[model samples]
Target: MPKGKRTRIVALTRTRKKGLDSKKKLMDDLRSCLEDYERVFVFSVRDMRNAKLKDMRTKWRTSRFFFGKNKVMAIALGRTAEEEQADGLHKLSKALRGQCGLMFTNSAKDDVVDFFGKYVEADYARAGAVATDDVALEEGPLPDFPHSVEPYLRLKLGLKTTLNRGVVTLLKPHIVCRKGERMTPEQTRLLKLMNHPMAEFRVNLVAVWSKDGVVERLNPDADGEEDEEEEGSGAEDDAEDMDSD
Candidate 1:
């Protein structure tokens, strides 16, 4: 080792150790969320853009939404879910098969369900998103784009572009994407450029748990109708998926 500038051992964080710590913290926080609310709603999230999620979180002042690794959520609610946390909450934890999150609200379950039913906002589709329908654009002057972007749009993005009156214009009409097609990076970019957002963002409330431990699933077979549950004790939810990551 040099006396003037000696090298010291740099501590490296082990992946397993760091991951375990993070998982533990997430479990603790989620358990706390479960304990705070009279009811917990399990819901699915898709195309969850962080900015929009943040805005929605801000708007819903009375409700708290916690999204995390599904495994962590399941573990936190309980290993068996029934014995560790309040009643029926384990059902929600058990159903954590995909991307999922829990919503803790003091509001009435019916009101929450109705709010979710009517709440839908359009957002840009990202790569890996499935196309719901064909998106076609007609040839026109796209004055929204500046003339400076014409070269990049034409050369890089495979779009026919020309400058007219200090604005960019599309030279031809073409189908941007087709139904059932998996969105590509280029397609996502082009949609954004065309200001055509393709994804519908909304919360699908799958299950709800009461403070007294009643659990009910929002039965989709009945046209998103609520299913009746035997009233009991325990505050638990086991439904839907919310993958925060």
Candidate 2:
């Protein structure tokens, strides 16, 4: 081959390698976006082009909360978490396999909690029903994704809230699952239990951090209730001492 032809071939090969390198770098950047975050929230996406999820992600980014796509995140799960997390995290990864949004923050827990509350409030009005399993299984407060269970506040609790309805109402809202169906008794029971305790999403998520957190570990289910009672009793005892003084 001519010297000029050989040079041309070498230049083309370098350009191709550069293109591959650029693609590799992009993937690495996406993965870094996931791994560097302090917490990972895994969610399922029903609609691939979810406008609400996109909006939530944009809102988080505006507030300096980093959001990333899940396919990229799944890669991090595969590479980062232990083999045990692989099954559960991978299941979560599969749930998030399609287009979904993520929010990241190194900010205070309250900030994250506030964000969740706002999101849930926004979506509550528009959502018909949410999956009880999903809500119960979530690490924190229910998401602010619309098309969930905020439409009917009358049926669920046999009570009503002034916020969703008029002052006369004394009920929390009823949630319908996808396809405009009602949640089963078990699901409703779990949701009502969580809601009554004012168990915010972050609180539950924090519980995952301890599997009990503020609640004692011995009895699991019974302990959370007992812990609250103990706190109440302690407060009463403090009040009595103050009265004696």
Clashes of each: 19, 16
Q: What TM-score, over all chains together, does every model reach?
A: 0.75, 0.30
Candidate 2 lDDT over residue span 163-238, tens digit each: 3222233233443233334455544554454452211122112111111112111112211222322222222222
As a whole number from 0 to 100, the lDDT of residue 186 in candidate 1 is: 82
lDDT of each: 0.69, 0.34
Q: All candidates: CA RMSD in angstroms? A: 7.8, 20.8
CA error at residue 179 for candidate 2, angstroms: 10
